[model samples]
Target: MMKSLTHRRLAELADVYGGLFHLKMGQLHMVAVSTPEMARQVLQTQDNLFSNRPATVAISYLTYDRADMAFAHYGPFWRHMRKICVTKVFSRKRAESWASVREEIDSFMKNVDARIGSSINIGEMVLGLTRDITYRAAFGSISEEGREEFLKIMQEFSKLFGEFNVVDFMPWLGWISYQGGNLHKRLDRARGSLDVFIDKIIDDHLEKKRNKKNNEGFDGLEEDMVDELMEFYDENGGTSNLGSAVGITRDNIKALIMDVMFGGTETVASAIEWAMAELMKSWDDLNKLQQELADVVGLDRKVHESDLDKLTYLKCVVKETLRLHPPIPLLLHEAATDTVVDGFKIPKRARVMINSWAIGRDKNAWDEPNVFKPSRFLEGGAPDFKGSNFEFIPFGSGRRSCPGMQLGLYALELTVANLCHCFNWTLPDGMKPYELDMNDVFGLTAPRAVPLVAIPSRRLT
Candidate 1:
């Protein structure tokens, strides 16, 4: 069966891993699992111990040893940091504060229109748009100023990290990747960028504070997560030391920004790419979708946030993308304390992999499991993504799940709808449609094995 594993080509994983099993990635023990009950029990029931994040040596070193929110476990400090995001930053009031998001959307459209009549790098382009949104929303800076330098450095770091890092499995050989000082060079670049961007933002905050310019007002930027993090940073004496008077550091806030920056950007871009690939695979699906878009949003206008409800078919396409190529396929949830499930003991600090990719296509859950059919979601039929059905979790469910589901969905809907409504895409240079490879080269975000290459012809608009 192990030998046949490679021969069968390792398609859907739920059928392969079953509930739990040990697979070897060299010396490391790789575990894969399926089922909503199991996921809930591990990530929710034992939320305390099981909410730990699998360590990131690269980011840990960058953050001066695991001070980042995404890398931190469930604890008082993490709680304090997360509150800044949940309450201060991403709160309804703050979201309203950043009304410029629509302006950014307009900027995105203008940029896309510039690429008309030419083959464009949609993947790279999407990253820039996401970065600009995040930078403005987080630090009130575009990704082009000194802050943009930090965004670019982190992007390079993530690109390298998205690759299979052999050192992750063999920590002893971590030096192999940095024999030429590559790791230090990247970390240095990131630190330099952070020094400039975050420092400038913080300085601006202090200046605003000195002038008392809306610093204490209800609608002021003080209610922002960045502002909260800075407040905590100042109260705590500028250190992430344990048992401090305040809570966390400025670096922790920046780390959270990086989390949204990477987690939010790559997945959104990949989802857009996957949606395009799947839609192209089925012309009938595209035409059906186009009719829906045309009815809801005529050719004279473009799809906006308000138009998302009418474009339900396009949403189905996004769901299927999550099914086939979930950005965080092996949703990482580390064990915080030892716990037992189904009479089996999971030791503390064990890495748990919710095989969402495999679960999405489980034959028991989906008909024609291997095929792409956006119509399956036409009715209220299959399990919704909330972990209720457990079969499809493009965004991992439970307490530690992605908090940016709405934001990610917004990017996905607007981008996919606009692309679909804006252009008729095709494989470039006479490439046969059937020859396109859909295989995935798994990464931090599972992306298409071959970059989805296509030409975009703008609509008559």
Candidate 2:
């Protein structure tokens, strides 16, 4: 098997061998599902059977033994965590209460405006904005040094999570591979750093709770996620309401914090970077989107969340970017019991990988699968990112679909729209539009191999 560019290789293999195929990775039985029909069966029809996550060394060690919602086994604990995230963290009300998103974007645009006329790294700028916004949303306000350190740790965690360890596939060779590659040491170091950072944040939250308790009349303050989760912890008598379950512990809170930090930051940043890369290459689409923006939002003002709905073309561009470059190209699942999918027998504990990248590019599902056309989504019967349309699921479908979908889309659309609306972007050094490098560095999220450096001139009213 070709180890590098594994997702693309899987797409090519699926093209030759049809939608469903089986392979063996050491002692692991693996199934690759690429087409929409197969996706429906695994994600919707037999979702329960394939709902559990396959344990990986990096994920298990970094995420507190799969205590996080994303990697937790499909069971009561998962349900409990998912409920907390949906209701307390990512609820529509909670998303709306974070007015800091707008404030952060304003700061971002000011930084961009300051660098006008000179080439700037748009990828880095987008990453900075997302990281700041996510940090603020997760833990109110953080110092510059704290934010920088947290971002560094998250980067290392993402890199280590995506790494391929031989011990994952062949356990018998664990001692040799673990000692020779220092995989255990690396995982331990990353996990330890993250735990310490999150622990401090949690302690701060506890202190704030104590202060809030002391205050008699303090209704003006807004509760962040930690406050909400802490409230739940206090209300439930320090026990998770899920019967007979070990209550939500400090470790669980830290694990969920890890999820929010990594999930909210990396994926949204990658989407924005990819969208900019695509628009940079496709001039017509860029112009069309700008025209829509001008018509919807005048030149005197910045793009607001309220204005996003009227700018349909901008939404389509985001959808198109997601289709071409899904953050997580392959969604992971594990079979909980022996089952048959598309007439192929899948054994219990088999690892299932749904190649969303291939599904988006499937010839039968999309016309000109390789093209970067946003109009496809503007047609009368076009699909959406809500996961109902299997062919267009940038976020996975069914039970384990991303709980942060609404918040993520809000961030992606807002950032992309403002960048396109406020400035006319040009490649640095007069490079041709089509010459932009679209190569991707694959990991937990696939970001551009080359950071996008472009010149931005404020658009005239």
Candidate 3:
């Protein structure tokens, strides 16, 4: 299996080679853990030794050499960054405080309404919805001039992060791959684009802050993510009172902003798209969800955030969908030290990949693993995806678990709930439920390989 280590191929290998298997790719020693027990060992039991992330050339360059939260080395700086995100940026109060999410969803519904009776690419539309929502949350407004281009460059990051580089696996022959300089050129272009775009955003935010302080008429725009991050930065030279040995700088701010943009948009979008696709292919489940929505949030109006808690079936659909189509199928980590896990030796710096995708579909962990049954989650003792349940870790576990999970889930649940409550969907071109394509394209996130094309009819009164 040295050819390619795509999640699907690795999962297939796990079926024959067992839960934990090792592979030596050139000079790099890699391990794949696919079972719940093995995954727990890597993600929970020995979490500290595996908390660090493995960076590719593209990731290092694009994220300003791991200054970002997602790939930052596990330490005081990473912890402080994550604390800022959890407490200030993605906290429960912060998530609910954003009127941007509601505004974006409303805008999305209106667009869908306009397309009623015509075929629409649900996946593409959902991606746009998520991108706009994230943009507003991070940048205070979606009116930035380079917003679309910034998003395009961010999308390019997904491909680059997952792209194969011979230098990564075999650094001894690094010169061989660089002779053509194709990957380097691409990485340079991506980083350069981000620097120009992100620098402008930071400059604008700084100017707004300065104007607000000097009694100049401030626009009174609600403080967005950039404003919050700037609280930690000192314009003079160092950090604010929240000083750190690993000082925060402009690169740090830009990297964190990139993390928010990339992490917040595509992953949530993919989950929403998968939820809708699964519902379209499973009519009974769709009916049950819509019925729940009607009982809790009547057809007279759209779903409100307040009504989300009562939409139990809607939550189940999302959980089941994640079980099958996790945004990042392969959770990447690197060994921080030499360690023995589950009676196996894990050497220092060895690359560890936990296949949450494979584990979610494992027959041993889930009953009728391949079936899309949201009802399974309604059962007592059902596992949750909140870092504790090894069987259902869509956002992953431990320190490196997605810090934006609260915000992402809020977007996923609200968008899916509104889509189902406000409209009824059907496969286009007279396509049968079984005929709809469920294949996924693996990248930084696993989105529908073929965009889900469907027709929407107004179901609300």
Candidate 4:
């Protein structure tokens, strides 16, 4: 958020309060950590105390008591919810079933190819790519107006998140009528729309459940996860390894959907934008990657998911992108009990925020703290970085790390590989690469300040 959103302000904050310090925005208390070791211990070794976020007024209302996985505290429910999401929602098999995702990706490249011939907005293009894939994967299809409803809600959520509310800091003042507080009002409206939409899906699934009572499930496809989980509940007398998969409520479903929709779209988009920005920032490194891609794979055949196995340098670039600009720089990990990190005591109930950005750029760990170098990742096989890695963290580590890491990687690999394979992008209107503003904005994910607008030319053009 610091580097991406308001760079100088954070730089000043870092200078004033030191890299790791706490700040309160209205009622919301945030401890922004920059050092890898400190960030790591909060998320990993001494995670119990650090993971719990100090609940704010927005969270209290918006989250339905924070029952969702993203905000919920660690306990049986957290473990159980994560398990269901990993095995049932974001399963290995579920990902494999959606050939449409690849098809949509291919469509995306075509759009990019066509747009590059003209002046295209890369930001809109990438956002569309993410939005479509996310909708399809979560729900069964993307054409419905319901899909648009979800997207609209997410966009509203992002916008509202950007504006600061004084009420969040001064809860005692409570419910201030500032524009930032309007986010809560907007959220309530979003919940109404989303609830009705999700309810319709659930009702339809319930009807399916009634019809299948004596006859097993329908379509073999079972289609949506709701149906599948419902069927499983019916079959097993209502209990999963995670506990009773039985009464997964509307709120539960919505919460999970929110986590997936928001986390799914935002982070992958961040990775794509960062990769492109970095490539533009350093042409020599960018060309080296392009050379590798060209030598092994060319533009005629799109960069397929199957091709990722051989594209080592491309993987390194993606990994390095994560290192430099991890979508969630500080993963939120809670302390389960009393713990200590780097000799600092973390009492129970302390909320931990790990700073992946500072860790990635640490002089102690990386040769150059600020420079973008993909090859550095190539030094180590596969570039593993959990909370323990201390030097790098993108998808987080330990139990609370994002389950959609693979999905994000696939989207990143396929899209970025195709972009490099197809386009010869230049700063729009011949602006020098360095002139491209790398400014970013703070939110759940860090987005470019001045959007990355590049002129795309075909290999022949």
lDDT order, best first, reads: 3, 2, 4, 1
Candidate 4 wrongly placed segments (more than 4 Å):
1-30, 53-55, 96-98, 161-163, 175-184, 208-222, 228-246, 333-340, 345-348, 380-383
Model 1 TM: 0.85
User: Which one wins by TM-score: 2 or 3?
Assistant: 3
What's the residue-level lDDT of 429 in candidate 1? Answer: 76
Residue range 1-461, candidate 3, lDDT tens digits: 44458888999889899999988988888999999999999898889899999897778888888988999888777898899888877877864335788899999999999999999988899989988888888887624677778788877887888788877777766677553288898988888887888788888888888999997876657778888888877544253434453346778888888888888888999999999989989999999999999888888999998999888999899999999999899999999999988788988889899999999998988999999999999999999999899988999999899988878898899999999999998887778999988988777788889998899999999
Q: Is candidate 2 or candidate 4 better by lDDT?
A: 2
RMSD of each: 4.2, 2.3, 2.1, 3.9
lDDT of 4: 0.68
What are the models' TM-scores? Answer: 0.85, 0.95, 0.96, 0.86
Model 3 stretches with alpha carbons more than 4 Å out: 1-3, 95-97, 177-180, 235-247
Model 2: colliding residue pairs: 240-247
lDDT of each: 0.67, 0.84, 0.86, 0.68
* Residue-by-residue lDDT tens digits, candidate 1, 80-122: 6566666665565665424545666678877878776676666
lDDT of 2 by residue, 1-461 (tens): 42623678888888788898988988889899899999999999999999898878888888878877889989887888898899889888885325767888889999999999999998888888888888887777533358889888888887888777777788788779545368778888888897888778778777777776888444355567777777655323344445543457666777788888888887898999999889989999999999998888888888888898899899899999999999788899999999999888999999999998889898899999989999999899998878889987779999999998888888889989999999999898879988888888767777888999999998956
Clashes of each: 2, 1, 0, 24
Best by lDDT: 3
| TM-score: model 2 vs. ground truth | 0.95
